[model samples]
Every structure is written in structure tokens, then in C-alpha cells.
Target chain A: MSLLEVKNLCVSFSAKGKEFAVLDNVELSVEQGSIMGIAGVSGAGKTTLLRTLNLLQRPASGKIAFDGVDIMSVSQEELRVLRRRIGVIFQSYNLFRNKTVARNIAFPVIIEGVNKKKALEKAREIAEELELIHRLGSYPSQLSGGEQQRVSIARALITNPRMILLDEPTSALDPFLTSRILRLVKRVNSVHGVTVIIVTHDMSVIKRVCDQIAYLEKGKMVFCGPTHDYFSEYYLSVSHDDHAAEQLEKAKKILAENGGNKLVRLVFWGEAAGEPILWKCSKGLDVSVNILYGEIEEFKHGPFGTLLVATCGKDSAEFLRRLSGNVYKMEVLT
Target chain B: MISELTRATLESLYMIFASGLLSILLGMPLGIILYTCAGSKRLASVYRVMDVSVNIFRSVPFIILILLLIPVTRRVTGTIIGPNAAIFNLTVAAVPFFGRLTENALNTLPRGVSDSAQAMGVTYRQFVFMVLVPETLPDHILNASVLLINLVTYTAIAGAVGAGGLGQLAINYGYYRFQWNVVLYSVIILVLISQGIQLLGTSLSRMLRK
Candidate 1:
């Protein structure tokens, strides 16, 4: 079921007497109890969209229905109540430097008028769960970046929010810390049934934890679907191969130098991912195939692979047609 | 001479304590107002009025301010030539001074602090008292110490106009009567007090640092 529905969402910022849309007529829907990753390059309005989701930044015009209520039209008092149900964690952790770890975790409950002693107790329990009990008395500055991030997560979770929005939560952490945070996020989602909407530029993060993915480019959501589908369609761009673009460039060079050779990019997911579809197609169509580059990675749902191949034969066109029908996606590079 | 010096010192301390306390109490809210209003679209006009008012009052020379406030001082305290009347003037001047200082202290906090607080559903009042004020307490203390030291100097200026403190003693006996030794003693005491407040503020601020 759709837990949050955003339609025709428009957000703009005016600077130096000029106005520009940060998010223009964007549309999205997040299913209940699912992890949705919003991915985009910097200045692509990913963060703006996340901020708009929690009503931290009001849009210029749009309809945002959260948990079946029109949040944009709610009164200030009602808005506050609605915000409490949705937790937000920032890129920098945003822990209270002045407060101890325990106090920082307990702050939301205290704001809700819970007794101070009870709030502290609740904070201690959450700190324990997040493996931060030993650092409870320390301030945010004293803790490591990962510890601070956990304290922030503990704070968000202590409120028992139905949904949590994390903005680049692991961008600053090392790989080991990043995995730990992702594990905690997954545990929170499954164990507590909390819906998660995370905005990140890292595709690996999306592959590790997100069930669905949304791709934004220049303030417009260009793709939104299951995680596997996004990878299949935009494999070259989103591949963990930092050299995907460079490799593609090199492939194009080779294709141009080797006359009469065809360069094709193929994406395979699900059942086709495990089969030798490329080899079969080459043999059946009587084409010579040279594998240029390939990557097979496991996503949350299953395995997805992208392969770039160079083919040379009289029946290259027939080979391409057969491969296109077998693979999830096929595109001509050169 | 010893007894008179003691009396002047006590009177100076009294005026400083009363005016400094009043300034902090009043100025803190003013500073919060300035910080909060500056960020609020609905309160843009309120921010402008306050910003201009603080600038206007801050620009007027302190000595000139005392003179200009004489009639108003008399209206409040029913006397315009003693420590009590000077306190009314001192507090009026120092309130805006400290208010601006508080605003600067609050501004030094990372923007994320307040943004996180708001995301957690805190009201504006709660944000100021619970998050903004506490987060900036160390800076606030340092700012307050600076204000208190300024207050000490202003008190001496007030004493020049018969406000009855160390300044009056120094001006009457040393400046007018040419008693250099008297001036030396008062100067030494003023320096001691200023250093003392600075030491206290620095220590307190350090202790509060997380």
C-alpha cells in the first residue's frame, strides 16, 4: 500500500532576484514498510525532495498526502503532531553537542512532556540497543562519527516514529561504519515495521538496503520502480564501477578502431541473470563475441548484471536481436 | 580615607551587580527575539524594527546617552545624581549591548542544531530555552563577561556625574584635586575587578564546554 503519495510537487528558491525550481513537478509514492532510496547527483534536488517529504521545506505547489492525510493543509498544531510521527536524520548526525548522548537520545520524549527520569531510562534502553550504552554520558563531540550517527538514530527511534527519513546518513563514514549503520537501518525496518525513505548519492547503499529506488535528474524524477529495474535500465551510469564511464569510452575507442564490429550493452536480472544467454545467442546466431566488461552484483531483491560485449560476424544484427529478447535491457554503444 | 574608599568600592559593586543582572535577564529574551525574528518570514518587519533599534541605541556614545537619559532617569528613580539613578541609565544602555551580544553568541551555533530541534517537533520557545540557549551557554557566558567589564567602565563614567562610586571618588579627589595616589588606588581596584570577572567567566565557560 502507498504510505506517502506526492503529486505535482514543486519547490523553488529565489536568489539574487531570480527564481529557479529545485524540484519541478516531481511525483513519487513510497509503499508502506518498505525502504525507498532516492538517488541523484548533487544539485539534482534529492535533498530538497527529502526535506519536502517531512515538510521541513514547504513546496511552491503540490499535494503531499502522508498516511492518508493532506499534510500541506494541516494547521500548525496538527503539523507538529504529524512531524513527530516522521523522524529525520541529517548527514552530519546533527546531535546536540551541548547534551550528553543519553540526553540527546531522550530529547524528543522530553519535548513531548514525558517525565525526565522516564525519558532518560528510555534513552538508556535505546542506547543499549544501538550499542552506545557505554558512551551515554559523553557528548556528541567525544564520540566517533559512527557513534554520533548511532546516537542520532537512537534519538529518532526513541520517539517510536512510524517512518524515518535519513539524508545521506552514511556519506561521512568509512565502509565498515557504513555497513553497520545500514544493518541497523534494516533491523529497525524489519523488527519494528518502520517505513524508511533514504536519500543518498551512493548506489551501493541503495543496493545494500533499499527495496525500491527513485532516480532524479535536474529536479525531475526520471525513474521510479523496483531496485532491480532501475539498475537494469541505467546500469552504466549507476554501476559501482567508478570507471564505468571510462570503460565505456575505451570500449567506444575499440569499436571505432575495429571496423565492422558492433558494441552492445546488455543488462540482465532475475532468471536471465543466472543463464548463459549471451553465449547461447552468439552461438545460435553464428557471431563472434568478445566480452569487454561485465559486472554482476546482488541487490536486495536478487542478482543484477550489466555486460558490454563486442561482436563481429555477418549475422551481428540477428545476434543483437536475439540478445535483446533474452536480456532485461539491451542498448547499442557503437 | 580607607573607609571612604571602601564605601566607593561597595557602591560600584552594587551598581554593577544590579545593572549587570538586569541587563542579562532582559537582554537574553531580546537576543532570542532578534535571532528568531531574523529567520522568520512572518516576522521580517519585527526583525527590521528591532535590528534598527539595537543599531540606533548601540551607536549613541555612552557618555552622551547618560546625559540624554537624565530626565527619563529622574522619572524612574526620582533622583538623577546618585548610584540608583545611574543604574536605571546603565541598564537601559547595557540591555541592547548585551542583547546584541547574545544574538551573536546564538548565531555561532551550527545551523544544524536548531534545524534538528525543529525537525524533532520543538516549539519556538522550547527551541530557544532547551536547545539554542543551552548550546550557546559557553559563548553566552563569555559575552556576558565582556558586557560586565563594559558595565564596570560605564559605572565609572556614571560616577563622573555624581553617581557616587569609584569613578566619582577618582574624579573628585584625583582629577579635580590632583591626588595622584588616590587615582592610582582606584585604577588598581578597577583593574583587579575587571580581571576577576574575566577569570570567572573564562573558568565557567571552560567548565561548561563539552
Candidate 2:
């Protein structure tokens, strides 16, 4: 069973007695010990979806099952245990302004009746792993933005939760700090084998740290798949037209230069994706193929590529027809 | 004359501190309830009642409130005239005033502070004591200072009901007997007390700021 399964979840807010759906018919499943990113533009309900999983924003209707137990039907005591098991980090970092870094991290542990001294020790250990040991005595306001975010991460981890939900963890950080935070998230997943569900508007964040991807749009789950598939498919599905158009323009220019040539765009996934497919396909086509545009992206699973190939004095339709059997997407542009 | 001045000054302090502390203890919770009820979807009716009631009670003149609480004051303290009675009336009047101020202070907290606390899986009770109260503590201190400064004026007015304080001494020796020295000394002492409270409160608020 998946570690967390949200099936057909719906949530609404009633303002002035009119109900507005915030999360509509959202379904998602996250496995144990995997890092998944939920990507969307603002108002897409990504954060709301994460909140629903934690049951913070109680969904109007849905069944969220964690470890085969329906979270919606759990008793209050069981719900508390469920909440403790699923940690959430907000964009603001939310370190209690008055408490020192160690105490802020120690708070949830102490609430569960751990000895304050032992809790602080546990906090220091996590802070050390996150490279925040030196700032343990500092208050939240005293830390820089990046340091504060690490402290927030430590506070979330101190509970030893099975899953952690991060909502725009790097939105307020600089580029260098953003990379550091992403690396920390990756390390936490690899080292601890903990499940992490991150909500972010930044595609770079998803590409950097997430093994799986969930795309939310207008309160709907538009796409969910492995990271490699997302990398190849995301650009095609979205309006990041410049990146796609740049390659297409190069292919077009080559096709124009090589009079009567065709532009064949190929997308490959899994073991089927790599350098050898280009060689074999060209050799099979019996025509000298000029590589117009080429790029390969490495995702969590493996490698994927979107290649724009062209041929002189020949149409590439026959070549593409054959290539379609092996690759995920193949299109002939003339 | 010196002894009399000292006694009036002490009486004023007694009334302000005793009633101020009691008012805070009672009013802060009242303010919390009002805030929680106002924010929660299920507590709309409770919020409406409390909101309107606070507004109404706040609008009542302090002198009228003092007179209105007289019977209960006498019942509680077993005396209708003295510092004890003044304290009782002062406390009852201050509860809604300070409650409103506490509510305002809590309202000034950024929404994210509360949202993050709820996301942390804190129970409602824990959210109040641990997060809500402390998150708004700096503002609460400032608000308390304003309330206390305002209450100093209220206490002097309580002297109208034979509550012994500088106001009574000024009325007896300065106004009725026309002794300008008694009036001037009392006014100067009151000014010092007000300044001391204002300065100490402002600095304390500044020191604890996040």
C-alpha cells in the first residue's frame, strides 16, 4: 500500500455563505521513502492539497488512507499520532520567534512528553546533520533566511516523522541558498529514507530534488508520474514555449538549409533513451542525417532526451514511423 | 501634609497595580475567546454575541460603570467606599477595556504565525498558551502599558466616590480650601507616576520585541 493515498478529495471555503472549491477532485498517492514534488502556479491548490494530506484543511469529501487506515475516520488520539507522523514545513519557516533554534526544534518533542534536555539533545543532532549546530543558540530572527529555513527543516525532522511536507521551502531564498536547501532535501531523502512531499511553484526545485512529480492545475491533479517522464513531458505539456521554441527554431533553420529536409523531434524514456538510438536509426534510414538540435536531461529514474533531427534531400516520416515504436514521442515537422 | 501626600500617592498605586493585574488575568482570556470565536467558522454566533457585548461595555462611561457596579462592589468587599471598593469597580470596568485592547493586539499578529502553529499539529489549547499568547506578547505588553496609563486617569476619577487618592486630596485641600500648593504637589506627583509608567512600559516593550 502507498504510504499516503488521497482519493477524490474535495475542499471548499464558504465566504459570505457561498462555497468556493479550493481543492476539487484531487487524487494522489505517495509511496513510502520517496521524495515527490507537487508543482503548480499560484492558486492551483498545491499547498491546499498538502494541507489536506495533513488534515489541516479538512477536505469536504475524500478518503485519505495512510498505511491502509482511513485518515478521515481515525479517532482523535489516532489522528494526533497521524499528525505527528506527517510533518509540515511552511514557507515562513515558522520558527517560534521567542525560542532559540534548539528549543524551537525541541518543541514538538517536548509536547509528546520527552524530557526537555533529551529533546534539545535530539534537536542538536538533527541541526548538526543539517549543518546548523553552530546556530542552535540563536533565535529565529537572528538567523539569515537560509539558516532559518534549515532550522525549520530541523524542527520538522526532530519528530522523526515518516513523511514531511514542504510548502515552497526555497521561495524566499537566493539562488545559492536555494541550491543548498535542495541538496539538504535530497540528502534527507537518501540518508533517512523518509517520504517527502514538497509543494513548489519553481520547476527547478522539482527537477533538482524530486524523484516523482505531481502537477496540480486549478485544484485538479493534471499529471502524476516518475521524474524522468515529467522532465521529458513537462515542457511539451506546458507553455514554457521559449525553451521548446529555441530548439524547434534550430531544427527549422537546419531543415531550411538542407533543402527538402524534414525536422523529426524524438522523445525517449527508460533504457530506450540514450546515444545509440540516434546511430542505429540513422544507419537504418539510409540517408545522411544531420543532428540539428540535441539535449539530454538526467532525471531521478534515468536519462531522457528531446532530439530535433534533420535530413537533406529526404523526408523523415518513414524514419519517424519506425522510431515511434521505440521512443515515447516522435513528430515530423516540415 | 507630607504624610497625607504619601498616603494619597500610595492609594493611587495600590488601585492601579492591583486592578491592572487582575484585569489582565481576566481580560486576556476574554480576548482570546473573542478572537478564537471570531476566526472559527463554527463559532460565528458566539463571536457575534461577544463582539457586540464588548463594544457596548467599552462605550459605557467609566464613571457610570463605577456607579453601576457599586452594589456588587459592596457585596464583594463588604464596604461601599474605600480603596477596596475602588479596586473592584476599576477591575470590572477595565476587563472589557483591556479585553478589547488584548483582542486588538492578538489581531495584529500576522496570519502566518497562527497558520504555522496549526500546521505543527498543536492542539487548540496548546496553540493558545504556547503560540498565540507568546507570538503576540510584545504587542500585548505595549497594549497593557496603554491600558495602564489610561487606568491611572480612571483611578483618579474613582476618587469621586470617596476612594482616597490624590484626586481626593486635591479636591479637599486645593479646590475646597484653595491651597494651591496641595494641588500643585499632587499634580506634579501624578505627572511623575504617569511618566514612570509610560517610560518603563515603552522600554520593556522594546526589549522583548522579536
Candidate 3:
């Protein structure tokens, strides 16, 4: 069953007497016990979508159902109850500067009127799990960025929330810290059964921890599907580097100059990603293949990649036809 | 001479303590209200009125403020001469000053602190007492210390107007009778009190900082 569902959501902001839409008719659904990543460029409304999920930013119009309840029409008391079930971690960590780490982690439960001693004990247990037990007494200022991020994760997990929304959780960390935090997120999902909806610009983050991916552009969800499919179908559009496009252009130029019959782009995923389809096709069909560019990325499901190549031979058409049958996708760039 | 000096010192202390307590009790809430009001769209007009009032009060000189408040002081204390009446004036003067200090202190708090509190679904009461108050307490203490020192000087000025304290002793003996010794002693005592308050405030804020 879907843990959360959004339909026809619209959010807008008025600035200087002009109303501008920040999110326009966006739709999404997150399955129970699954990890989904939301990716977009700056000002693409990625953060706004995340905030709207928790009702931090109310939409102008839409329906959001959480755990089979339409949250948009819920009473204030019911809304509060829904909020308790969904934890949110911000980009800046936002630990209370005056509170000790222990107090910061235990703050949610403490406000719920839980016994202070019991809350702190539960906080300690979470801190230990997140490897922050030693810094329990220290203030947030004393910890490094990675440790602060861990503390934030610990606080989010301590509430035993059925779902957690992380807004650019690893945007401020280095690569090593990013991977460590991602590993912790995966563990939280697997061990605690918490549904995760993380908004990030980093593809590696999506590849590492997310089972599904959603791409937002200009406040609209452009693509949403399984992780490998995003890598296969829409990876180039989201990748900031224009290397693949450049390579495709270069391959076209070479094909034009060298009189090659066709320049082709191929995508591989799952079992096809492991097979040497290009080499087998060339040797089997007596065609000469020139690999212009290739990149393979590891996703949660498996390896997915894109390749651009130039082909020239008597049986090049047969080689192309044979290669198309084995690959996930084939595009002719002649 | 020693007994007179002691009496004047005690009187000054009484004025400072009473006015300081009253100003903080009134002022801290004013500060919190101002801070809260500024963030609210519905309270924009209320914030404007309170902001203008605070600025107007803070702009007037303290000595002139005492003179202007004589009628109000008389109504409150039934007399315009003595430490009690002086305290009434001092509190009136200090509340706005402390309230502005509080607003500035709360302003220095990061926006995320409140955002996180709201995300946790805290009640409005818990957000104020648990998050807002404690987050800014150290700044409050430091501002209060500064307020206390200002109150001490105000107390002395009030004494010059028949509120019996060190200021009256210095003026009557040292200024009129040319007994420079009394002025010297009073200056030393006032300096000591200011220094003591500053020291206490610094350490208390430091202890509460983390």
C-alpha cells in the first residue's frame, strides 16, 4: 500500500504584488517501506515539495493522503497527530544551540509529556545506534558537520516516525560524510521500516539509497519511476555535466567525416549491463564499432549505463538490429 | 558619617533591586511580544504601535523622564519624594530599554530553531517557554546586567530630587557644603556596585551559555 499520496497539488507565493507558482499541479506517491529520492535543479521547487509533504508549506489546492487519511481536510488536532507520524530533517541540522545533544535528541518526546528520564534513555539508545553516544553531553557547536548530521538523523529516528522527510540532508557534507550518512539512512529504512522521501540534487545519493526517483523541473514532476529506469531514460537530462551530449555530438561529427553509416546510443540495465553485447555483436556480424563515450552507474537495483558508438561495415545494419534486441534501449543518431 | 553612608547605600540598593525586578518582569514579556508580533501578519499594526512607543520612551533622557513622570509617580506612591517614588520612575524608564534589549536578543536566534520546534509539533506555549526563552536566556542575562547598571545611575539621579540615597548625600554634603570627601566615597561605592553587577552578569551568562 502507498504510505503517502499527493494529487494535483499546487502551491504559490506572492511577491511584490505578483503571484508566482512554486509548485504546479504536482503528483506523487510513496510506497510503504520504500525509499524515494526527489531531485531537481535550484528553484525547481524540490524543497517546497518536501515541505508540502509535512504541511510545513500548505498548498493552494490539492489532496494529500497519509496512511489512507486525507490530510488536507483533517482537523488541527488530527493534523498534529499526522505530523507526529512523519519526522523531518532540515538541511542545516537545526539542533537547539543551548540544549545538550542528549536534550536535543529527546526534545520531541519530552514535549509529548514523556518522562524526562525515559526520553533521555531512549535518546541514548538512538545516539549509540548513530555512533554519537560520546558526544551526548556536548553542544551542537562542538561537533563536526558529519556528527551534527548524525545527531539530526538520530533525533528524527528517535520519534519512531513511520516516515521521515530529509531535505537536502547531505548537501552540506563532504563525500565521505555523505556516504556514511547515506549508509545510516539505508539502515534506518531496512532496520526500522521507516519510509524515506529525501530531496537531493546529488545523483550518487539517489543511486546509493533510493529505490525510486522523482525528477522535478519548473515546479512540475517530469519523471517518477524505479531507480534503474530513471538512470536509463532520464539520467542525461538530470546530470549537470554535459559530457554525454558532447560525446554524442562528437560521434556525429566523426560519423559525418569518416562516412560511417550510423552513430548509435545504447542503454543497458540489469542483466544486459553485465553482458558484452557490443563486442559480441561486432565479432558476430563483421562490423567495426568505435566506442565514443560510455558511463556505467550503480543503482540500488543494479548497474545502468549509456553508450555512444560509431559503426561502419557491410553488415552494420545487421549488427545494429542484433544489438537492439539485447539492450534496454537503442537510439539511432545517424 | 559611617551610619549615614550605610543608610544612603542601603537606600540606593533598595531602589535598584525593586526597579530592576519590576522592569524585567514587565520588560521581558514586552520583548517576547514584540518579537512574536513582528513575525505575525495579523499583528503588524500592533507591532508598529508597540515599536513606536518603545522607541519614544527610550529616546527621552532619564533625568527628564523622572521630572515628566512626577504626576504618575505621585498617583502610584502617594508622594513624589523617596526611594519608592523613585523606583516607580526608574521602572517606567527601564521597561522599554530592557524590552528593546530582549527583542534584539531574540532576533539573534537562528530561524531554524523555531522551524524545528514547529516541525516537532510543539504547542505555542512550549515553543515560547521551552524553545524561545531558553535559547535566548544567556543574552537576556547579559542585557539585564546592562540594565541593572543603568538603573544604578538612575537611582543616584533620582536621589538628587529628594529620593534619599547616595545622590542626595553627595549633592547636599559635597556640592553644597563642599565636603569633597562625601562625593569621593559615594563615587567609590557606586563604582563598586556597577563592577559587582557586571561581574555577576558575565559569569552567570557564561555558565548558562552552553
Task: Return the top candidate by DockQ.
Answer: 1
Q: Evaluate residue A130 in candidate 1 and report its C-alpha lDDT on the 0 to 100 scale.
A: 93
**Taking the tens digit of each residue's C-alpha lDDT, what string does model 3 give over B40-150?**
899999999999999999999988998899899999999999999999999999999999999999998888878878788888788889999899899999999999999
DockQ comparisons of all candidates to the true complex:
0.70, 0.59, 0.62
What fraction of the true interface does each of the listed models get right, in terms of native contacts kept? 0.67, 0.50, 0.61
Screening candidate 1 with a backbone cut-off below 3 angstroms (N, C-alpha, C), the clashing residue pairs are none
- As for DockQ, the candidate ahead, 1 or 3, is 1
By summed lDDT, which 10 consecutive residues of candidate 1 chain B come out lowest? Answer: B109-118
Q: Can you write out model 1's per-residue Cα lDDT over A1-334, one digit (the tens) per residue?
A: 9999999999999999999999989999999999999999999999999999878899999999999999999988788888899999998888888899989999999999999999999999999899999998998889988888888899999999989999998899999989889999999999999999999999999998999998899999999889987777666463545577788888878777876478888898877899989778877576788888899998777788889989988899998988889998888876
Tens digit of lDDT per residue, candidate 3, span A102-220?
Answer: 99999999988999999999999999999899999999999998888888888888889999999998889888888888888888999999999999998889988899999999999
Q: Which stretches of candidate 3 lie over 4 Å from their true place?
A: A235-241, A257-259, A279-290, A312-319
How do these models rank on DockQ, best leading? 1, 3, 2
Candidate 2 lDDT, tens digit per residue, A52-92?
Answer: 88777789998899878898998766787778877788888
Off by over 4 Å in 1: A236-265, A276-292, A308-327, A330-334
Docking model 1 quality class: medium
- Model 3 clash pairs? none
TM-score per candidate, chains pooled: 0.92, 0.93, 0.93
Weakest 10 consecutive residues of candidate 2 chain A by summed lDDT: A232-241
